[model samples]
Structures are given as C-alpha cells and as structure tokens.
Target: MRIKAYGLVEFTKSGYVKTQAVVLTLTVVLLIFALLWQPTGMWAANPVFGFLEWWVLLVLIAEVAETAIMLLKFKEKEAALR
Candidate 1:
C-alpha cells in the first residue's frame, strides 16, 4: 500500500477524526444514560452492567490525553515552521 509522505497527515485524517468524534459523542451519551439508570433490575445485582456508570472516567481521561497530544503536536509543528 502506498502512503502519503506529506508531513502531519494524521492530524487531518478523516477516519481518525471521525473515530475521535464518535468516542467523544458516545462519552456524553453514556454519561447521560448513566445518570438515568436506576440500578433496580439486573443492574442492581450485576457489577458488569453497572460498570457503564464508571465508563465516563475512562472517557474523560482518554479525551484529556487526546487533547494533550494534539496540542503538543501542534506546538511541535509550529516550532518546525518557525
């Protein structure tokens, strides 16, 4: 497979951008769902199903890391262009 040799390609990749956006959107949706879950059914007895409430933590962390990396990459490229 041929790969583009253009610098900073991943920064503008559509697939990667879509994946990131989906992750971020799902994170918000799940957080809202977790807030509405009553935990009165199988969720009451099963820890696995209940774990969805805690998924926001992972999502938050992932978003933070993604943001940091993007910022760092931007600055790196900025310095290179100087």
Candidate 2:
C-alpha cells in the first residue's frame, strides 16, 4: 500500500481553493445581478434587498480578496518547501 503525504499549508490551501473558486463564481454572478437590478423591479422591490445589495457585494469582494491573498501566500510557502 502507498500513502500520500501532505504539509499543513498544502492541506489548508487545497481546502480553501475549492471553496474560494465556488464562492468567487457565485459572487461574480450575484454582483452582476446586483448591478443590473433595479429598485423598481418586481423581484427587487423589497427595500431590504435594494439597500443591502451594495453591502453584500462589498463583503463578497473583501472575502474574495482575502482568499486571493491567502492563496498567494500558500503558493509562496509551497514553493519555499521545495
């Protein structure tokens, strides 16, 4: 039997990479919809959704940026290990 070895950083990075990709894709789609959504639109007429749209986008952007920074750091760490 063969066993695979992984570093702590590598494991952490692999976990986050998949999650970040999914979140980023969903965020971009949501951002586009938010940008195109109108306050008067039937679905978005709710004051809460209209008011929160920009905030939601800002939060998502911050999250994605943080994930990107972490990914870059992880890559550097992985490179250093080699």
Candidate 3:
C-alpha cells in the first residue's frame, strides 16, 4: 500500500521547512552549550547573547506548538475526508 503521513515529515518538505529545522537544531545545540558553559548563571553574561537565547527558546516553543496544531488540523481534515 502507498502509505502517507502528515505533520513535519510529510506535510512540510519545502525549503522553509529545511531552513527552520536547521535553525531549530542549531538553537537547541546553542542552548545546551550555553547552559553547560554557565551551570550557575541564570543568563548569559553578554546582554545581547542573553536576548538571543530567549528569542531562540521562544522560537523553539512556537515551532513546537505550531507543529502540534498543524498535526491536529491535518488529522481533522483527514477524518473529515474519510
């Protein structure tokens, strides 16, 4: 059978998705690095980098929430078509 899926894997395979994925991965890696580099610090020492860190976290969260909403919408659409 020709199987199909939705969400990030099948629904989004465009250039934007690739760029978003790469940026998301890099942000996560940077977050980990920042945390590791400053085990006790609440924020990065540099104010600008700290702002960037927050922006990355917010973007990551928004991406996750957006993906979940898209998956739910796709499932609803599929069900309606059935």
Candidate 4:
C-alpha cells in the first residue's frame, strides 16, 4: 500500500519551523530553571526570576502564533495546488 501526504513535509522543511523548535526548547528549559530555583512565592522578591518567567511565557505565545500562521499559509497553498 502507498500513501500520500501534503503540506506537512514542506511545513517541517521551513527554516522558521526549526527556529521555533529551538526557541521553544530554550524557553521550556528557562521555565524549568525558574520554577526549580524558586518553588514558592518569590516573584515579588526576585525581579530577575520573575522577568525570566514572563519573558519565557511571551516567547512561547509568539512562537505558537507564528506557527499557526505558517500552518494556515501552508494549508492555503496546498488547497490551491489541489
């Protein structure tokens, strides 16, 4: 049996996808570090740790938005091809 797929391969090949993956990984690591370093209510006490956590969250949101846009574009292109 044979199967055909569209858009996914091209989507993965995009440079932005790779960049987003890296950014997501780094943000996750930063989030873990922030949580481990301060397990309790320390955001008010520690500005740097709080800032790091907020920055990681914002980056994650941005990455998700970008990925969604890219996926929509790929879908539109594939539909046009068909």
lDDT of 4 by residue, 1-82 (tens): 1111233443343655676688789878887776566534755567666576676777778878867776677667667779
lDDT sort, best first = 2, 1, 4, 3
lDDT of 2 by residue, 1-82 (tens): 1112233333466667776788888888887777777666665777767766687688797987787677677777778789
Estimated TM-score per prediction?
A: 0.60, 0.57, 0.52, 0.58
Q: Which portions of model 3 miss their true places by more than 4 Å?
A: 1-24, 36-46
lDDT of 2: 0.69
Question: After aligning candidate 1 to the native by TM-score, how far in Å is the CA of 54 from where it should be?
Answer: 1.6
Model 2: residues >4 Å from true position, as ranges? Answer: 1-11, 40-48
Error of 1 at 37 (Å): 1.3
What's the ranking of the predictions by TM-score, best on top? 1, 4, 2, 3
Could you tell me how far off, in angstroms, the CA of residue 38 lies in candidate 4 after the best superposition?
5.2
Of 1 and 2, the candidate ahead on lDDT is: 2
At residue 1, give the lDDT of candidate 1: 14
* Poorest 10 consecutive residues by lDDT, candidate 3: 1-10
Candidate 1 per-residue lDDT, tens place, 1-82, comes to 1112234445444454566688778888888888787587666888755776677767767796875676566567667769
Better of 2 and 4 by lDDT: 2
- Superposing all C-alpha atoms, what RMSD in Å does each candidate have to the true structure? 5.4, 6.2, 7.2, 7.9
What is candidate 2's CA lDDT for residue 25?
Answer: 89
